[model samples]
Target: AQSVTQLDSQVPVFEEAPVELRCNYSSSVSVYLFWYVQYPNQGLQLLLKYLSGSTLVKGINGFEAEFNKSQTSFHLRKPSVHISDTAEYFCAVSDQYGGATNKLIFGTGTLLAVQP
Candidate 1:
Protein backbone atom coordinates (compact mmCIF):
# COMPACT_ATOMS: atom_id res chain seq x y z
CA ALA A 1 0.00 0.00 0.00
CA GLN A 2 1.08 3.59 -0.64
CA SER A 3 1.34 6.31 2.00
CA VAL A 4 1.61 10.06 2.49
CA THR A 5 3.07 12.36 5.11
CA GLN A 6 2.09 15.92 5.92
CA LEU A 7 5.04 17.52 7.68
CA ASP A 8 2.98 20.06 9.59
CA SER A 9 -0.02 19.15 11.69
CA GLN A 10 -1.07 22.78 12.00
CA VAL A 11 -0.46 25.98 10.11
CA PRO A 12 -1.48 29.40 11.48
CA VAL A 13 -1.67 32.65 9.60
CA PHE A 14 -3.38 36.02 9.58
CA GLU A 15 -6.22 36.92 7.28
CA GLU A 16 -5.20 37.24 3.65
CA ALA A 17 -1.92 35.57 4.40
CA PRO A 18 0.23 33.09 2.56
CA VAL A 19 0.66 29.42 3.39
CA GLU A 20 2.25 26.22 2.16
CA LEU A 21 1.21 22.70 3.11
CA ARG A 22 3.99 20.20 2.68
CA CYS A 23 3.24 16.72 1.32
CA ASN A 24 5.36 13.68 0.56
CA TYR A 25 4.49 10.24 -0.68
CA SER A 26 5.93 6.75 -1.01
CA SER A 27 5.00 4.16 -3.64
CA SER A 28 6.91 1.59 -5.57
CA VAL A 29 4.72 1.96 -8.63
CA SER A 30 3.16 4.87 -10.43
CA VAL A 31 0.62 6.86 -8.41
CA TYR A 32 -1.71 9.81 -8.59
CA LEU A 33 -1.55 12.81 -6.26
CA PHE A 34 -4.40 14.70 -4.66
CA TRP A 35 -5.09 17.38 -2.10
CA TYR A 36 -8.36 17.68 -0.28
CA VAL A 37 -9.73 20.36 2.01
CA GLN A 38 -12.33 20.08 4.74
CA TYR A 39 -14.08 23.08 6.17
CA PRO A 40 -15.27 23.09 9.80
CA ASN A 41 -17.80 20.23 9.72
CA GLN A 42 -17.84 19.52 6.04
CA GLY A 43 -16.61 16.54 4.06
CA LEU A 44 -13.36 16.56 2.13
CA GLN A 45 -13.31 18.14 -1.31
CA LEU A 46 -10.75 17.72 -4.03
CA LEU A 47 -8.42 20.69 -4.19
CA LEU A 48 -6.18 19.44 -6.98
CA LYS A 49 -4.35 16.53 -8.51
CA TYR A 50 -1.23 15.63 -10.52
CA LEU A 51 -2.16 12.78 -12.79
CA SER A 52 -0.28 11.77 -15.92
CA GLY A 53 0.21 15.02 -17.74
CA SER A 54 1.77 18.25 -16.56
CA THR A 55 4.03 18.61 -13.57
CA LEU A 56 2.21 21.79 -12.54
CA VAL A 57 -1.45 21.63 -11.65
CA LYS A 58 -4.00 24.21 -10.50
CA GLY A 59 -7.15 23.81 -8.53
CA ILE A 60 -10.03 25.86 -7.23
CA ASN A 61 -9.72 28.79 -4.82
CA GLY A 62 -6.31 30.09 -5.77
CA PHE A 63 -4.24 27.03 -4.97
CA GLU A 64 -1.66 25.08 -6.95
CA ALA A 65 0.89 22.27 -6.73
CA GLU A 66 3.80 20.82 -8.64
CA PHE A 67 4.55 17.13 -8.97
CA ASN A 68 8.20 16.39 -8.31
CA LYS A 69 8.91 12.77 -9.12
CA SER A 70 12.51 12.83 -7.96
CA GLN A 71 11.61 14.23 -4.56
CA THR A 72 8.39 12.18 -4.34
CA SER A 73 6.58 15.32 -3.23
CA PHE A 74 3.60 17.36 -4.27
CA HIS A 75 3.39 20.36 -2.02
CA LEU A 76 0.48 22.80 -2.10
CA ARG A 77 0.97 26.57 -2.13
CA LYS A 78 -1.02 29.76 -2.19
CA PRO A 79 0.51 33.22 -2.44
CA SER A 80 -2.32 34.76 -0.40
CA VAL A 81 -4.97 32.94 1.55
CA HIS A 82 -8.18 34.19 3.05
CA ILE A 83 -9.79 33.56 6.41
CA SER A 84 -12.26 31.39 4.60
CA ASP A 85 -9.39 29.17 3.63
CA THR A 86 -9.01 28.06 7.22
CA ALA A 87 -9.75 24.37 7.25
CA GLU A 88 -8.33 20.88 7.56
CA TYR A 89 -6.17 19.77 4.67
CA PHE A 90 -5.13 16.28 3.67
CA CYS A 91 -2.65 14.88 1.21
CA ALA A 92 -3.51 11.63 -0.47
CA VAL A 93 -2.35 9.14 -3.11
CA SER A 94 -4.03 6.46 -5.19
CA ASP A 95 -2.55 3.65 -7.21
CA GLN A 96 -2.73 4.39 -10.88
CA TYR A 97 -3.75 0.83 -11.62
CA GLY A 98 -6.22 0.54 -8.80
CA GLY A 99 -9.86 0.28 -9.70
CA ALA A 100 -12.53 2.84 -8.93
CA THR A 101 -13.12 1.37 -5.49
CA ASN A 102 -9.44 1.67 -4.61
CA LYS A 103 -9.58 4.04 -1.69
CA LEU A 104 -7.02 6.76 -1.15
CA ILE A 105 -4.39 6.75 1.54
CA PHE A 106 -4.14 10.11 3.35
CA GLY A 107 -1.85 11.84 5.72
CA THR A 108 -2.90 12.28 9.34
CA GLY A 109 -4.25 15.82 8.72
CA THR A 110 -3.40 19.49 8.87
CA LEU A 111 -5.49 22.22 10.49
CA LEU A 112 -5.12 25.67 9.01
CA ALA A 113 -5.91 28.50 11.39
CA VAL A 114 -6.54 31.89 9.85
CA GLN A 115 -6.84 34.84 12.15
CA PRO A 116 -9.14 37.66 11.34
Candidate 2:
Protein backbone atom coordinates (compact mmCIF):
# COMPACT_ATOMS: atom_id res chain seq x y z
CA ALA A 1 0.00 0.00 0.00
CA GLN A 2 1.08 3.58 -0.65
CA SER A 3 0.74 6.43 1.80
CA VAL A 4 1.82 10.05 2.20
CA THR A 5 2.74 11.95 5.35
CA GLN A 6 2.82 15.71 5.73
CA LEU A 7 5.09 16.58 8.61
CA ASP A 8 3.52 19.97 9.28
CA SER A 9 -0.17 20.53 9.63
CA GLN A 10 0.22 24.28 9.32
CA VAL A 11 2.87 26.70 8.05
CA PRO A 12 2.66 30.42 8.76
CA VAL A 13 4.82 32.92 6.91
CA PHE A 14 4.91 36.61 6.17
CA GLU A 15 4.07 37.91 2.73
CA GLU A 16 6.99 37.85 0.26
CA ALA A 17 8.95 35.43 2.40
CA PRO A 18 10.01 31.91 1.43
CA VAL A 19 8.22 28.84 2.65
CA GLU A 20 8.35 25.06 2.36
CA LEU A 21 5.79 22.34 2.99
CA ARG A 22 7.32 18.97 3.66
CA CYS A 23 5.99 15.74 2.26
CA ASN A 24 7.13 12.13 2.45
CA TYR A 25 5.78 8.92 1.03
CA SER A 26 6.10 5.18 1.54
CA SER A 27 5.31 2.60 -1.11
CA SER A 28 6.26 -0.93 -2.02
CA VAL A 29 6.14 -0.40 -5.78
CA SER A 30 6.72 2.32 -8.33
CA VAL A 31 4.51 5.34 -7.68
CA TYR A 32 3.47 8.71 -9.02
CA LEU A 33 3.38 11.80 -6.85
CA PHE A 34 1.44 15.05 -7.04
CA TRP A 35 0.87 18.34 -5.25
CA TYR A 36 -2.38 20.20 -5.15
CA VAL A 37 -3.59 23.44 -3.66
CA GLN A 38 -7.07 24.41 -2.59
CA TYR A 39 -8.38 27.82 -1.82
CA PRO A 40 -11.32 28.51 0.39
CA ASN A 41 -14.47 27.21 -1.30
CA GLN A 42 -12.53 26.07 -4.35
CA GLY A 43 -11.71 22.67 -5.74
CA LEU A 44 -8.24 21.15 -5.67
CA GLN A 45 -5.94 22.57 -8.32
CA LEU A 46 -2.99 20.64 -9.67
CA LEU A 47 0.20 22.35 -8.56
CA LEU A 48 2.76 19.86 -9.88
CA LYS A 49 3.33 16.20 -10.60
CA TYR A 50 6.11 13.63 -10.85
CA LEU A 51 5.23 10.86 -13.26
CA SER A 52 8.78 10.10 -14.41
CA GLY A 53 11.92 11.58 -15.88
CA SER A 54 13.20 14.67 -14.09
CA THR A 55 13.30 14.65 -10.33
CA LEU A 56 12.74 18.39 -10.14
CA VAL A 57 9.27 19.51 -11.16
CA LYS A 58 7.95 23.06 -11.40
CA GLY A 59 4.38 24.15 -11.09
CA ILE A 60 2.16 27.20 -11.23
CA ASN A 61 2.57 30.33 -9.09
CA GLY A 62 6.34 29.84 -8.88
CA PHE A 63 6.15 26.69 -6.79
CA GLU A 64 8.52 23.77 -7.31
CA ALA A 65 9.35 20.43 -5.76
CA GLU A 66 12.25 18.00 -5.92
CA PHE A 67 11.53 14.31 -5.94
CA ASN A 68 14.07 12.48 -3.83
CA LYS A 69 13.87 8.75 -4.34
CA SER A 70 16.52 7.79 -1.80
CA GLN A 71 14.84 9.81 0.91
CA THR A 72 11.33 9.26 -0.39
CA SER A 73 10.49 12.92 -0.07
CA PHE A 74 8.95 15.58 -2.32
CA HIS A 75 8.95 18.85 -0.46
CA LEU A 76 7.19 21.88 -1.99
CA ARG A 77 9.00 25.20 -1.94
CA LYS A 78 8.49 28.75 -3.11
CA PRO A 79 11.03 31.55 -3.04
CA SER A 80 8.43 34.05 -1.90
CA VAL A 81 4.81 33.93 -0.99
CA HIS A 82 1.77 36.18 -1.23
CA ILE A 83 -1.27 36.64 0.96
CA SER A 84 -3.24 35.05 -1.84
CA ASP A 85 -1.04 31.99 -1.44
CA THR A 86 -2.82 31.20 1.80
CA ALA A 87 -4.58 27.91 1.27
CA GLU A 88 -4.56 24.21 1.93
CA TYR A 89 -1.83 22.17 0.25
CA PHE A 90 -1.91 18.46 -0.23
CA CYS A 91 0.55 15.76 -1.22
CA ALA A 92 -0.64 12.58 -2.85
CA VAL A 93 0.67 9.29 -4.27
CA SER A 94 -0.64 6.53 -6.47
CA ASP A 95 0.92 3.28 -7.61
CA GLN A 96 0.86 2.02 -11.22
CA TYR A 97 -0.88 -1.29 -10.59
CA GLY A 98 -4.45 -0.10 -10.28
CA GLY A 99 -4.58 1.01 -13.93
CA ALA A 100 -7.90 2.76 -14.41
CA THR A 101 -8.54 2.55 -10.72
CA ASN A 102 -5.29 4.08 -9.60
CA LYS A 103 -6.66 6.18 -6.80
CA LEU A 104 -4.59 8.75 -5.01
CA ILE A 105 -3.67 8.42 -1.34
CA PHE A 106 -3.43 11.95 0.06
CA GLY A 107 -1.71 13.41 3.05
CA THR A 108 -3.51 15.03 5.94
CA GLY A 109 -2.91 18.45 4.35
CA THR A 110 -0.91 21.53 5.34
CA LEU A 111 -2.39 24.96 5.72
CA LEU A 112 -0.31 27.88 4.47
CA ALA A 113 -1.16 30.96 6.46
CA VAL A 114 0.38 33.92 4.71
CA GLN A 115 0.47 36.93 7.00
CA PRO A 116 0.90 40.52 6.01
Candidate 3:
Protein backbone atom coordinates (compact mmCIF):
# COMPACT_ATOMS: atom_id res chain seq x y z
CA ALA A 1 0.00 0.00 0.00
CA GLN A 2 1.03 3.61 -0.67
CA SER A 3 0.49 6.46 1.71
CA VAL A 4 1.47 10.10 2.05
CA THR A 5 2.33 12.16 5.09
CA GLN A 6 2.39 15.92 5.35
CA LEU A 7 4.45 17.02 8.31
CA ASP A 8 2.80 20.36 8.83
CA SER A 9 -0.87 20.96 9.32
CA GLN A 10 -0.45 24.62 8.58
CA VAL A 11 2.32 26.82 7.24
CA PRO A 12 2.32 30.56 7.85
CA VAL A 13 4.37 32.93 5.76
CA PHE A 14 4.44 36.59 4.89
CA GLU A 15 3.95 38.01 1.42
CA GLU A 16 6.89 37.53 -0.94
CA ALA A 17 8.58 35.17 1.48
CA PRO A 18 9.81 31.72 0.58
CA VAL A 19 8.02 28.62 1.82
CA GLU A 20 8.32 24.89 1.70
CA LEU A 21 5.62 22.32 2.41
CA ARG A 22 7.08 19.03 3.47
CA CYS A 23 5.70 15.75 2.07
CA ASN A 24 6.89 12.21 2.57
CA TYR A 25 5.57 8.94 1.26
CA SER A 26 5.72 5.27 2.16
CA SER A 27 5.24 2.61 -0.49
CA SER A 28 6.32 -0.93 -1.09
CA VAL A 29 6.08 -0.62 -4.86
CA SER A 30 6.93 2.11 -7.35
CA VAL A 31 4.61 5.09 -7.23
CA TYR A 32 3.87 8.43 -8.83
CA LEU A 33 3.86 11.56 -6.70
CA PHE A 34 1.91 14.80 -7.08
CA TRP A 35 1.17 18.12 -5.42
CA TYR A 36 -2.24 19.68 -5.68
CA VAL A 37 -3.63 22.97 -4.43
CA GLN A 38 -7.19 23.87 -3.67
CA TYR A 39 -8.28 27.44 -3.49
CA PRO A 40 -11.31 28.83 -1.74
CA ASN A 41 -14.50 27.57 -3.44
CA GLN A 42 -12.50 25.89 -6.17
CA GLY A 43 -11.47 22.47 -7.28
CA LEU A 44 -8.07 20.84 -6.80
CA GLN A 45 -5.42 22.04 -9.22
CA LEU A 46 -2.27 20.24 -10.16
CA LEU A 47 0.76 22.07 -8.84
CA LEU A 48 3.33 19.57 -10.11
CA LYS A 49 4.02 15.91 -10.62
CA TYR A 50 6.86 13.42 -10.73
CA LEU A 51 6.23 10.52 -13.05
CA SER A 52 9.79 9.84 -14.10
CA GLY A 53 12.93 11.40 -15.56
CA SER A 54 14.46 14.36 -13.69
CA THR A 55 14.14 14.64 -9.94
CA LEU A 56 13.37 18.35 -10.05
CA VAL A 57 9.95 19.21 -11.43
CA LYS A 58 8.50 22.67 -11.87
CA GLY A 59 4.88 23.60 -11.83
CA ILE A 60 2.65 26.63 -12.25
CA ASN A 61 2.58 29.65 -9.93
CA GLY A 62 6.28 29.68 -9.30
CA PHE A 63 6.20 26.41 -7.39
CA GLU A 64 8.58 23.50 -7.70
CA ALA A 65 9.41 20.21 -6.02
CA GLU A 66 12.27 17.80 -5.83
CA PHE A 67 11.75 14.06 -5.83
CA ASN A 68 14.13 12.46 -3.36
CA LYS A 69 14.08 8.72 -3.67
CA SER A 70 16.26 7.86 -0.71
CA GLN A 71 14.32 10.08 1.68
CA THR A 72 10.97 9.26 0.08
CA SER A 73 10.19 12.96 -0.02
CA PHE A 74 8.75 15.28 -2.62
CA HIS A 75 8.69 18.59 -0.83
CA LEU A 76 7.07 21.60 -2.49
CA ARG A 77 9.00 24.87 -2.42
CA LYS A 78 8.48 28.41 -3.63
CA PRO A 79 11.17 31.07 -3.69
CA SER A 80 8.59 33.71 -3.02
CA VAL A 81 4.93 33.56 -2.15
CA HIS A 82 2.00 35.89 -2.57
CA ILE A 83 -1.27 36.37 -0.80
CA SER A 84 -2.97 34.45 -3.58
CA ASP A 85 -0.85 31.45 -2.73
CA THR A 86 -2.85 30.90 0.41
CA ALA A 87 -4.74 27.66 0.01
CA GLU A 88 -4.97 24.04 1.02
CA TYR A 89 -2.14 21.98 -0.39
CA PHE A 90 -2.21 18.24 -0.75
CA CYS A 91 0.33 15.54 -1.41
CA ALA A 92 -0.80 12.43 -3.18
CA VAL A 93 0.64 9.15 -4.42
CA SER A 94 -0.60 6.60 -6.93
CA ASP A 95 0.60 3.11 -7.42
CA GLN A 96 2.48 2.82 -10.67
CA TYR A 97 1.33 -0.74 -11.15
CA GLY A 98 -2.25 -0.16 -10.08
CA GLY A 99 -3.52 -0.55 -13.66
CA ALA A 100 -6.35 1.56 -15.11
CA THR A 101 -7.89 2.66 -11.86
CA ASN A 102 -4.92 4.87 -10.99
CA LYS A 103 -6.43 5.59 -7.66
CA LEU A 104 -4.61 8.24 -5.63
CA ILE A 105 -4.00 8.19 -1.89
CA PHE A 106 -3.74 11.67 -0.44
CA GLY A 107 -2.37 13.09 2.76
CA THR A 108 -4.18 14.97 5.50
CA GLY A 109 -3.35 18.24 3.72
CA THR A 110 -1.46 21.41 4.66
CA LEU A 111 -3.06 24.80 4.89
CA LEU A 112 -0.84 27.59 3.60
CA ALA A 113 -1.69 30.83 5.35
CA VAL A 114 -0.14 33.87 3.81
CA GLN A 115 -0.09 37.06 5.83
CA PRO A 116 0.48 40.44 4.41
Residues 12-115 of candidate 3 have per-residue lDDT tens digits of 99999999999999999988999999999999999999999999999999999999999999999999999999999999999899989979999999999999
What ranking of all candidate models by TM-score puts the best one first?
3, 2, 1
1-116: candidate 1 lDDT, tens digit per residue:
79999989999988877888999999998999999999998999999998889999999999999999999999999989898899999999998889878679999888989898
lDDT of model number 1: 0.92
Query: Which segments of model 1 are wrong by more than 4 Å?
Result: none
lDDT of 2 by residue, 55-90 (tens): 999999999999999999999999999999999999
TM-score (all chains, Cα) for each model: 0.95, 0.97, 0.98
| Models ranked on lDDT | 3, 2, 1
Better of 2 and 3 by TM-score: 3
Question: Which residue window of length 10 is worst by lDDT in model 1?
Answer: 95-104
For model 2 the TM-score comes to 0.97
| Alpha-carbon local distance difference test for all models | 0.92, 0.97, 0.97
Model 3 scores a C-alpha lDDT of: 0.97
Candidate 2 deviant stretches above 4 angstroms: none
Error of 3 at 7 (Å): 1.3
Q: What local lDDT does model 3 show for residue 45?
A: 94
